[model samples]
Target: MSLQDLHGLLSNLQRNPGIPLDLDWVDSIRVNRSAAERRAATLPARRTVKKKYQAAWLLRAIACMDLTTLGGDDTPGTVRRLCAKARRPVRQEVLAALGAEQLGVRVGAVCVYHQMVPTAVEALQGSGIPVAAVAAGFPHGLSPFAQRLDEIRSSVAAGATEIDIVITRAHVLTGDWRALYDEIAAFREACGEAHLKTILATGELGTLTNVGKASAVAMMAGADFIKTSTGKETENATLPVGLVMARQIREYLDRTGYKVGYKPAGGIRTAKQSLDWLILMKEELGNEWLLPDLFRLGASSLLTDIERQLEHHATGRYAATHHQPMP
Candidate 1:
């Protein structure tokens, strides 16, 4: 992929409208655990990037990141601060040193809780940075079904262009594929023009095989993006889980001729880890998935580490972590 393309950032890609639920296809899904682990383990060692190319990759990672702030203590002030950070993820000196100051580098979106959607919207006004609200009871999808739909509608009405909805784990656990499909389809409908990102909470779903099946059901039900977790689970994003999800995305594209996005949230905290994910996208799904529209790293602190790395690349030494603080 050309490094020049990263400057354009977010794309006006077509949304995944979804296809009819294919129960047969869902049941046919299977993941080889050992193979996935082996592949993921070997991925990092296989490719190494340095100098200007590595800097370019890091910038691309920032562009695809969903700078997020989802916490009980989160206030509007905190939300506004987070929006400011999203608008200019890298420091001016760092971007200028890399000759990227004019690139207009920015995060893919700013994610927050339902109540903070408007606050983020107002802060990010006219910046073209989409505001993503986490709904459906957030980390837990146990709220009343109607209430979940209501939450989605309210956020969209408040100006959230994207809605990150969690799926009912019980539906996947009980092998109720139809229930999962119906749940996501309803969330998609409520989203309307707003994009729908379905969180599988893969860590709680039991096995990698279940991860594959859940991913298929989400895409079949019309999830514009299938996220790995809500970032609250004991086990958040992992390479094995991501590999399984990427494979599902590839299969979905081959079968239905539609493209579904993939996001690996939580536990992804370093610049090196970000490069690993970008390599995974380029190797498995090709270059298109590297863009913000198809890939997102749901992280809050990851940006700090990325900025520090960029600083290190620009100069020859590391700066104190406080220099790259987040709100």
Candidate 2:
């Protein structure tokens, strides 16, 4: 389906209303590292969509991206520019040449720090793209508990409709499942109507098993989405880690009948990598999981590369990266 068609489809699906904690289900989770690694190794070699179909898949990927700017140097001007890009992610000529100009294509959302939420909101007003703010002591998530919750509230008040909270990695490392659950649940309550995405920081969670367990706990504790990383970790959003999290989401849905979204952020900067992640979602969880509501690529430069590829498809030649600058 085209991005325009998918937009209407996503509008009708209800947001994930979280369920109560189920300790047994959480504890039963286990990750077979070798098997997961082997499966991830085969993704790139397997599914390869080409030509017009490839362009279609690329458009779908664009609609599922969270165009992001999380650096300490981010300013309102930068956030506004990012929002503008979010409004029209691809060049009009490229989209028109592909016969996709009428589709009104755009990225899934604009992710930024709390300070940039208002700017993003204002820039994206009437465009229907949500402003997602990374809160609750982002990156390390080591601040005091009260302050973290307060930060979420403040971001929401500032017009952020999505709150991406960082879970205390220590909770996962120490086997403090209850603490993690309570912390995430409280963050959910603070979110009010906004969606909550719990970042597991899979790289620092020690093992794939820990990543699986943490994913289950966060879902049980009412995380609307389970994110793979904060994009600041040394190793972030690997396919192996994404597979573990995706399986956990499938397991949670089977047990509770509540579908949780999955996001793999950090280091996903290429068009091929985007297609790989899309194939993972389709094969692992089915086509329904490929929508913006259930999947988002946390990226900035990824859009630039995707645009370059689409231009190549339209013109039969690749353009220089400088010609496709991101907002």
Candidate 3:
């Protein structure tokens, strides 16, 4: 086999493990971009509206998404409860229902800890909903690179399509841009065929300027997505950080012509807040940015509120009796 064939084979073996390598792994990873785009073409605006701004985004909240919180105060039982209360599985059927028009489930993907990749992988096997896993000693990047690398490999072994990694704050804070770049580049390599989302822990990054600079560096070092925070810091996912990161993404896209996705997670538990992020996307990136391809809200509690809003929209009044509030 030629060099390209070898590279492709190894990449696939690295991405899709368990089965012995026989066919071209690269071929398995190859996607028909045109076909995917054609199939995934956003539905045309079936319902027209005259309003300049709308809270229609509340219809798409991924409620009770149990992001693995390995940090203090977050437990496995908590995750189980959240998933139980969600009344949904990580199966592709569930993701299909979410993206389908019937119930119009709007969750982008189920976010989980590195250990739960198997659950999501099994649940979403052959499903479009990507299994997203947190890495780089998520909640904090204090762990060594070896640990982070192991996390990435394990998640990939468990079939995570996307890896969310935390950036080394000390390096970035100390103006060690090269170190930061290298750190992210390592993750990019470990990701192989999967998408990489680098988190800046924006709340701890101190300023909007740093957030913007960090976004640029992360994107430059090959981040397919630059997430705002890990939702475990003193504060997670603030508008200022979102605004800063979005502005930088717009700027970077303008300069490089590469559209990098953005995710703002944490504290976005209300429909109003979620819509506010959508509004930010609309104002900054225009109407085309409204899709989940380029934007996502990393939220755990926003769903019930979104559902409530959807109910309110469908009915004349919001019903508090039928809905049970989540912790």
Best by lDDT: 1
For model 1, the local distance difference test gives 0.91
Candidate 1 has its poorest 10 consecutive residues by lDDT at 1-10
Please write out the lDDT profile of model 3 over residues 196-255, one tens digit for every residue.
888998888765556766777787788878898788778887655666677777876776
Residue range 158-244, candidate 2, lDDT tens digits: 999889999999999998999999999999999998889999999999989899999999998888889989999999999999899
- Roughly what TM-score does model 1 have, to 2 decimal places? 0.97
> How do the candidates rank by lDDT, highest first?
1, 2, 3
Q: What is the C-alpha RMSD of each candidate to the true structure, in Å?
A: 1.7, 1.3, 12.0
Supply the global lDDT for candidate 2: 0.90
Off by over 4 Å in 3: 1-55, 61-104, 321-327
Candidate 2 vs. true structure, TM-score: 0.97
lDDT of 1 by residue, 1-327 (tens): 433345334346767889889999988988889999999998898897999899889999999999999989999999999999988888898888888887888888999999999999999998888999999988899999999999999999999988999999999999999999999999999999899999999999999999999999999999999999999999999999999999999999999898999999999999999999999999999998988879999998999999988999999778899998899
Ranking by TM-score: 2, 1, 3
